[model samples]
Each structure stands twice: as structure tokens, then as C-alpha cells.
Target: MPGPDYCDVDVLRRIRRRSLAALRADVEPVPPEVFAGFLPGWHEVGRLRGVDGVAAAVETLAGTPVAASALESLVLPARVVDYRPEYLDELTTSGEVVWIGAGASATGLEGWVALVPADAVADLAPDRRVEITELSQPARWILEIFAARPAGVGRFARELAPEVAARAGATAPPLPPPTPAEFAEAIWELAWAGFLSNDSLAPLRARLGGSAHPATLAAPATRATRATRAPRARSGLRSMRARRRIDAPSTTAPHLSGRWSLVPGAGEATARILGRSLALVDRDGVVLRGSVPEGLPGGFGSVYRVLARAEESGQVRRGYFVEGLGAAQFALPEAVERLRAAAAPAPGPPSGLVLAATDPAQAYGAALAWPEACGPGGHRPGRKIGACVALVAGRLVFYLERGGRSLLTFTTEPGVLAIAADALAEAIRAGRLGRITLTTIDGAAALTGAAATAALRGAGFVPHPRGLRLRGAMSRPESVSPAAETTAASGPGAGSGPGSGLESAGGCVDA
Candidate 1:
């Protein structure tokens, strides 16, 4: 059965991920097209024989005996779409007018001959011979030569010369020697056809060097070299421009120098911070390249906003360009610092974070102090918040979090919360927090399922089942006050019980 057709973006991402892994593993896969069949309209040909036919065909056309081996060898490599029904009819007739010959420019004369079966010879024109020439040496040989080697006219010239010379009274045409330029062009053609990836083009480009037309053929490769030497480039380019903006130079500008921030405490620590201007451009580039992460805030609006900022800053002077959305999520502070050091100087770190505005007003308040106060990197200026809510199969699943927690946990499905449970358990063990209480308006099955099972056994945490009454009781309490309440409800209430918005049968627990 055929699989679902994946989107172009997903396919590119999977390919990139797979290729990167293979590189790390020290394995190089053959180009995708080799096994996938890059030759357009080409199909595998299989052999079939009707024994009575060959002897008569050879007698009529080649005027010699036809052996099965010779026929098999000749036709195996050549492609045939269909076999003529009367193929055996004209082959064996006495004075059989078995074949007709014609020449065409595309195939050469070097023309195709039909196998005329002997029994049908009386129906043939008197002057004809069985046209098994189509099945004979020349046609099959030419097809085989072209299929084996795929250089254009040059390949045909070299491979077909001896055969052409061997044909009756024919002098072989002089073979046109391929120039290095021609070879390079062929490489590029193959690359464009997806038979060669950009990674594989490196050595080819190095070989062509300055001779290759349009320096941009290797532009991506050149930028890679420059980026690997980026620290030096960053220093030199910084010394050259100093505080000046390096208006989007090309697709590579983001990788080299876009935004920068000094490492805190580690005097030598450098970070490549992506400023609003660069991030915007890089985001657009990422979309074009199809690497947009799912559930991240900002659609094309984010892109347009970035473009507007670039225009305002006079940063993006070029017509159009593409690049990736440089490492957005960072694990280590040092890595963030490294990124900052590599970045172009910005007025300040980009303030707006990229988050879904699930609870925009509250999330905004959280954003002002986020990352800086709660997470690794300091607070970035631009606040783009994305809420974690996905509509899977028409079910509205909300990813929830309480006040002052970087750990995102929410679930409509029990399996989805497994990662969060493990994380919560680890946090508790490390003394990062006290107790991780999950209060869901769910049935007993959720607590007994794999998520709870793993948490109880693997993480040594206890699972507490909560009742649905808390949800109803909290929703419309007869009397409640803003300041009078001390604890927050576990599920959803202003603030009254557990203080963290989590509620179970034992009472509200800090979510």
C-alpha cells in the first residue's frame, strides 16, 4: 500500500535530519535518485520468447540463424513498449517481404524493424523482408549504450563510435571529447535533477573553482567555509563595520553575524543572539526552506512584521533571501552565550518571545519576567507567546501550566503527559520542588495507565485521583472574593484552594 504523501516541508526536514545523522555515523548514502529511478519515463524491461519466431526472423532479416542467447543478449538492455501481434507471421515465408525500413532524425536509421512472423508473409508487400532489425543489434546496442552512461551527446559519441564504424561501409563519426566545463555542467544538471545533493556538490565545485560560471553555484558552500571560520570573520567583520549594520548581505548573513550579546560572568563566553531584524529575515527564509516548527506563534504575520522592522532599520536592502530560524531553543547558558557573541550588536536583546498567547494578558505578565527570571537566557524584548493547544481529530487538547513553572504539562490524552510526569519527578528528586500533583477532570483509567504507572514505579512518585466535583464546585461558587481567597483551585478558579490551580480529591494541590 502507498503511504500518505508527506508535505514538502516535512520531507525536507526528515531528509535533513536523516542526512545529518548519517554524516555523524560516518555513513554516506547513495544519492536518492539512483534507486528511485531518475530517468523519466523509463521502466524495467523483461524478456519473453515465442520459439517458432527467432529462426524465421533471422532467416528473413539478418539472413542467418538466430540463437536464443543472441536475441536475449540484444534485447535485454533495450526497452520495448509492446510486441506486434503478427511478429511471427512474416519471418519464415519464402521470398517473404517481411520488413519495412525507414529513418528518423531522433533515432537515426538506425531505424526500428518489426519482426514479421512467417505465417503472415502472404499478407506482406512483395518487396519486404522480416523487419526484425528493430530487435537486431544496432537498435538494441544504441539503447544499451545510452542507458549505461548518461552524458548527453558526448557520452553517445564515445560509446557508440566502434559500433557505428563496424556497420556496413560506414565510417565512425569522430567522437567529441568532453571539456571539463561540459563535465561540470553535467554535474550541475544532475544536482538540479535531485540526483546529487548540495553536500555531494562540494568536491565538484572545488574542482571547477573559478572557472564555473555564476559564482553562486557554490555560494552556499562558500558561505559554509566562511561560517566555520566565523569567529575570525566575526572579529574582522566587526572591526571593519564596528557598530554599523551589515544589511542582509545574502542568505548567509544570519549564520555569520546577526545579533550579539556579551556572556555574563564568563568574560570569554560569546553568544549569537538573533535580534528582531535578523530573526524576522531568518524566519521568512526558514518558511521558504520549509522548516517552520509546529505550534510556534506567528504565521506570515510574523514574517511581514519582521520585514517591516528590517525596512525600518534599513537592514534588509536586498530583494529577497532565505536562511534558517537560527537555534531558537537553547539548553545551555554557555550555548546561548556563544550565540550572543556571534550575533551582530543589537540595541537590546529581542524582547518579544515566540509563544502562543493562550492566556495573552497573563502570559504577557509572565513574559516580562520570563527566561530572565525563570529560564536560562535573559528576557528577550519582543513578546511573541504561543499557547500549547492542539486540535487533534476534532478534540480540543489544552497544554496547561501553573504560575511560575517552565514545565509545560497538560493533556486530553493520558499518553501525551508522560514526558511531563518524568520531568516533574526529576525536579522533585533534585529538590527543585516539593510535590508534583496532577489533578485532571478525568476518569480512573488515566491514573492507572502507563503515564501514572511509569511515574509511580520509575520516578517513585504517588498518583492521586481527583474528582470532577472540584471542577463544578469551583466554576460557580456561591460566594468568592478576590482578596479573601488564600489558595488557587487545582483545575480552574481565580485563586482559592491549592494556590497553583490544581485540584484532586485530597484537596487542591499546587499544579
Candidate 2:
């Protein structure tokens, strides 16, 4: 009987379809030739009659589930062979396309066509040598060129064109550099074989840098940069006034010069007097003395009340109202000392703190101290104490009130906060809490500056008119469960044991 016809067009189409599908799914598509060897009387066929015969044989067995499964399971060994330009040309002439499955922007066709000698392939890991190869003269020439310059083929070709010409020998015509398209193709092929180097593309990139599409080169302004520039345009007067206030020369302003000290007798009486004045003082204790600006709210009495409360809570250490400049000055010893330490030069990497306290009292104490320890100008002295502390990356990251309000957050190294935020986020997700909110005063601008705000933003905090808030990552429940809702509503550190408040209403208090 005549050997089974192996050149049927229908069989070729089916094989091609299956191969494409396999490739699309990232599964290695076995060449039809592998299956041809298993077919009955396959050896009887006169020769491997081009690609058609292999396809036909594979198609004939397609209907047989056992045969098809065998073919599907077959994994051909990947062999590395010398690169041959002729093979590529032949494949192209036959309307065959090779998918590179990698970026090929640089050395182009030259890298692909570069010869990988048998010895070179042998030197590689066995599994790395993906295709069996037949050597060709062109492949050898390209390999020699590449060997001459190990840095990259494109750079060698461009920067050392004369050397390449000398390598070609007197009788051989000067080797013309590959065109862009040819180079791209070579790069693609080389990349598929894992031989392409990004450095090799440097020369091409340098040459084409100016030629990139305008749209591709364009970059939008970053949010942080935009945020910094936004307020200037909308409130030029306010910006200028603020700048003047900070930069204005002062006489006998001890706080401005960072030379101020707490007055010996300054206490609750002094706090009452200074609070009434609503004075703005530098961290050093120099009060910005001047007439109260028009339209400024919160008279001295209201200010006094707040200061008295803070003093009673041990947040304010000392205060004074200077009649000479019509200004009030307050001293927070802890805050001032902290500022001084920050300015003092220190050797070695700064120390870091990471705490996870199970005792609510301890956690609360730390939370109260955080504002002074890490706040910008030192903590504002007094504010509502935090109820619970959130541990992020095993560190006490921030404290929250009973209502899920963020009272204070401790600063860490440059990138630590982001990590901690992510950890907290994971905890919230695991706990299935819908969300958490952090409340801060704009007056706390001294502590929570732009950088801290930006970091918080990265950690999924969004600024609302009220304050910065972060929502839970867990999906909202369809029907709110009463127990779960109550737990979430109670906030992070709602139920505290005894002695959760300040140990003594005396020294500096923060947060």
C-alpha cells in the first residue's frame, strides 16, 4: 500500500492551529515532525517532505484520542545551534513567522544571526541549549564579529566600524551594518534564546533617543509636585504673608534665635496669660510678637481655656505673655529638648523603635508620648490621649481614638512608614473591619508636614476636608452584622483597663 499521504493541506492547517494555540497559552508547541516519528509506517514515507508531510501525518492521528494525547504530552528537547541567516530567510520566504516572545529593540538581527558555535553551546547548561543546530558561514562571521567585542554588537559595529572592516580580511567586502529592521529581527531571535543583553541596545537607543514619538517621551507632573505648587496660585497673599512671618527679622526674640528657656515661675497663671494672647512662638521659645491680625478668630480667653486644659493635662510646661511685644510665649521642655537633639550632630545610623504592647495602659502611654517624641515641633503638649496603638511591621506605627480616629503617628526611616501602613492594611483586611479614620488638626501642621502627608497618601490615606482617612480593604458586607459593626464602631482602642490615662498630670504630655 502507498504510504499514507502526509502532505494534506487540511492536516497542515490543523497542526498550525494547535501549535498557535499552544504558543498562545505559553505551552511549548511541539513541532509536527515529533509526532510523525510515532505514526505507523512513518519511516516508510520517502523523506521528511518539507513541513507539509509532517503536518499531514500529525493531522491523520488527530482523530485518535490516544495518539493525540501522546503528541500533546510530547516535549521536544530545546537545542542551541549556530545561528544561520539562511534558515531565517528560508522560513520567511516560506511565509513562516517565528514569535520571539521577548523585547528586541536594540542589537536587532545582528545578535540573532551571530553564530553560537558548538563549543559555546556545549559550555552552556544542558537544558539551556534549546535547539539542535547546523552551522553556516554567515553565522560564523557574525559570531566572530561579536567575539571581537563582548560589550555589545551594536556598540562594536558603530564605534569600532574600522576594526570590524579589518576583521573581514582584505578580500572580503567591508561588512555593512545591518539596517534597523534587520537588527530588530536579530535582536528578537537572540532574545528568544536568552542571549540578548539590554546593554547591547544602548547604541541603538542613543541613536534613536531624539527620534522617539513625542507622546511616548511626555511625562505627566507627579501628584506631590503638583500639590506643592497648587496653594501658591490660589492664595498668593497668604503664602507671601506666611513666608514673611517665618523670615522676618526679630529683636530680643529668644525663641527665634533658639536661645529661650522656660521661665522659673511660669506655670498655670502664666499659661492663662499666654493662652489669652494666642501667641505664635518658635520652637525655641521666641514668640512672634505683634498685633493680632484682623479677622483672626479665637480670642485670648478661648485660647486661655484650651491652654489651661492642656496645662492641667501636663501638656504645657510653662508659658509667659510679654507686654513689651504684645506676644505670648509657651515652653514645652520635652518638645524643645527633642528639637535640640534633632539639630545636634550624631554619629552612626539613628536608632529606631518598634514596639507591640499588649497592655493597653502601656500602649496608651506610648501613644501619648509619640507626639512629643516624633511630632514636628514636638507634640502640641496636650490633646486627647490616644486609645489604641496600631502595630505595623511589628512596630507601634500609630495611635487611634475609640472612634477609629488617628490621633498620632510615629515617624520612622524613609520607607518604613509605607511598609507599616501596608502591614496595618493587611491586619484590617484580616480583621474584616470596613475602614478606619484618622483625625488631626491643621494646627498640627508643625508635626504632620507635607512629607508625612505624602507618605500617608501612599499608604492609602485620602485627605478629606476634616482630616486624613483610610478605608478598609475588605469588601463591604451586604447586610451589616450587629456585632461586627459594633466592634468596628468602637474604634481601635475603645475598651481600656484601669490606669489607662496619664500617670501624673505634671511633666510634658503629648498627643
Candidate 3:
């Protein structure tokens, strides 16, 4: 069989669909061997040291020249992934030492006093496949970048490719097998790191090595950032925007190791795990008057300090950054999906349907309004009159007939107002109906009264004043007294009375 087709949109759509179906694939970094030749001054790890050595290596690796064998010492076991930092103060102010390792487990720190659970470095690995026989500061920086933003790794990798390629000179390797999973992992990391924008070099898809394109990178990152930030941002920005948007914050929007958003306007600001709060900075670089609350997992408490300084100067960026954290640390794809959906764009009204009537139908003639995404078999409830109290698909609709002649249908929800306005104007142009007069009624059941009027207008029923007078005279044929007429009106089966003509459709009777 041939290999998978390449395209950014296709990759994004496929991942989105697969993720929705619970069949998501994992992104793994390319092997070190594939790109070994490209990385100059690379070193290999020798033997595995215990947890203490690994921690020491982490503390000093940034400043010291790394040997090849140091990578082995940094490898994380799987067990450490289970421990999460609960109290913010313990890890930062307490001077408590946290273990950062290649394996997933925190066992190396067991029985060691002052030892606290730490984020696994392996959790930050990018999803792409590349060979590396040696190590360098840049590689370490790349690892840290992944740790901070697991979602953006793929895009970031593409960004770093030119730099890395430039550094490689004649030693640059061929394009490695950078699969979709790796691209996704890269994206996750980038998102975590506050690189919220997509920098996909489109029309140059072949350069990214995998089948992914640049456009695919745009929405997920934007959606993830919006979903993650909306709750906090909505309240802060409400006073600025002209229109007020209804915000639905995440309740089950996963709170993986990274901060997840909560519902908007629920009395929560940018929540910080530490006691300190983050100041809100708008897109225009203006900081809100009040300080915004910002939260961080225990290991990243130091980041808040940096952010606070930035906030004071009104230059603070509003996003989270985990220094050197990897993608696997808090793999909550489910939470990510929830946030994405919550932040997904709301669809516009369906095209081509006009609103003919609304509740309080008596006051207004046939007014047109925009039709909602409702009706029979339109996945909307309250399509029938008196269906339910709750507004489903905006409002209730009822079919009507005046004098037993079918008339136009109407929507009761106020969303139909704009629709009605536009549609009625069109009808007047087409000469379908006369001047449209819209009305409002208190309830869906009340619209039954206006049905007759709307039916007359729709069917162009010509009223005969003389004919009505004759019927009235017939009712009082022998000079019947008003008291007798009242008695005759009250005595009824299903004819011109409360329960009349509705027995086939669950008629009501007043005992």
C-alpha cells in the first residue's frame, strides 16, 4: 500500500475526526540516529545514573558541556508521571527539590528527604522522528520548548528547521520521517508555550518532511488557546468589546498539568496556583486596570515571578509557559477536545427561510423574519405549538389555518425579528403579500388566536359584512333573548366551544 497523503488541512481534519472518534495517534520524536550527522558537536550518553545523578545533571546541564552519556542519565522512567504538584508554595518557596527525569516515575527520589514529585522531562518530547547521535545547548533548548508547549512542536520544528539547517551547513541530513503524531505533539507543546499563532510555511509542504500543511496548524492552536483562555479573558475584555458574547466556560475542560479555563463571569479571574495573580493584557498591549489571576503547576512557579515583572511594566504577555516541560507530562487530549469544542465558532442562521409570524400574532400583519435551524426533521424541538417551555432552536413554531384555509407558518422566538424584517421586505418586492406588520404575543399558545388573521391575509380571504350580519340574525331567529344565546353557546360537544374540533389531537375539556 502507498503512504498517507500529505496536506495541512487533511492532517488537521483527520486528527480532529480521529480524536473525536477516540482513535487519536501519539506523536513521537524522530530517533537521534536519523539526524546525527546534522547536529554538530553532538554527544552520546554512556551509562544510566540513579535519580540523584539525573537531578544533578539537570541543574548543571545548562551551563556545562554535555557529554554523549549524559542523555542516558536524563532519561525519565514512567512512574513520575503520576505525581502532580498540589500545593504551589511547597515546590517554590520551600526550596523543596523536585526530581526531573527521563523516565516516567519519581522512584529515584524515594526515601530522599526534601524530595518532591516533578514533571517528567520525557513528557516534553516532540512528535517528529529525527536522528540525533549527539547533544547540544540548542537540542536542550528544543526539549525545553516542547516541555512548555506540547501542541506547537510541529510548527515550532518547522520554524527551527532553517536555523538548525543553517547550523548544520554541509552536515544537514535528508528530510526525516516527521509523522502526523509528531506534528501534533509539536503543536501541543507550542500551544503550551504561548506561541499561539501558526507559522506554517504553506506551499512548501515538502519542507516540513511530513504530509502536514500550514493551514491545518491555524485553527487547532487558535481554538485551543481561545478555549483555554476564554473564561479568564471574557470577563477582563467584556468592558472593551461593543457586543456582549455569551460565554460558556469549561467545567470538564480538562485541567491537565496545565491550567484549564473555567466558566466565564463566575467570579473567578485568571487563577494562579501560587498566591500571586496575573494581570490582564489585551491584544492592544494595554493592561487592564486590575491585576489578573494567573496559575501555574508547582514546578513552574518561578514563571509567575517573571510574568509579574512583565505585568508591572504593562508589557506582560498573557499565557502560560512551562520551562523545559515536554508534551507527555499532562496528556489530556479529552480535556483539549472539550476546550476546542467550547471555543468552536457558533454557526450562522440557515439561508433562504423567512419568518412569517410570531407570538402576539394579532397586532401585526404577516411580518417576515429569518428562519432558525428548526422545523420538522431539522434537529430542533418545539417545532409544534405548545410543545415545551424551554426554547429549543430559539422558539416554537405552529401551523395555522384561518377559516379552515392553510396560512403561513411563523416563529415565536425573537431571533425571527431580523429574519422577519428582511423576508417581509423581500415579499413586498415579489408582491407575495401586502404590507407586513409584525406583532408580539406573550405565549406560544396565544398565537393560535392570530392564526385566523394571518390565514385571512395569506389566503386573501374577502370578508362579507352582510354575510356576517345574516349569520348573526339566524342565530337569533325567533327574537331569542341574550340569556338563551348564552346558554346555547355554553352547551357544546366539539362545536365552536373550548374542546371543539380537537378530539383527534388530544383535545382539552373544561368540566
Total clashing pairs in model 2? 18
| Model number with the top TM-score | 2
C-alpha local distance difference test of each model:
0.26, 0.30, 0.24
Compare the candidates by lDDT and give the number of the best one.
2
Candidate 3 lDDT, 84-190, residue by residue in tens = 12221233223322221111112111100011222222121111112222333344334444445554233333344333333223233532222333333333332
**After TM-score superposition, what is the CA distance of residue 335 in candidate 1 from its true location, in Å?**
15
> Any idea what lDDT model 1 has?
0.26
* Candidate 2 local lDDT, 1-511, one digit each (tens): 7887767888886876665444324322222211111111221122334334333322222111111001111100001012222332233223231111112223221111111111122111111122314322333334455565533223322222223223333334634433333333333343334333222222222222222110111112222211122223345443333333222222112111111111111125444344333222211122222222112244444444554454444455333322222224333445334333433445763322211121111212311223343554322322121123444322345544333333456565546666655544543443222244443422242114455556666766554333444554433533435564354334323323222222322111111
Off by over 4 Å in 2: 1-371, 376-386, 391-395, 432-434, 441-448, 473-511
Candidate 2 at 253: error in angstroms?
A: 66
Per TM-score, what order, best first?
A: 2, 1, 3
What are the runs in model 1 whose C-alpha is more than 4 Å off? Answer: 1-275, 281-400, 403-420, 431-434, 441-457, 464-511
lDDT agreement of model 3 with the native: 0.24
Q: C-alpha displacement of 294 in model 2, angstroms?
A: 50
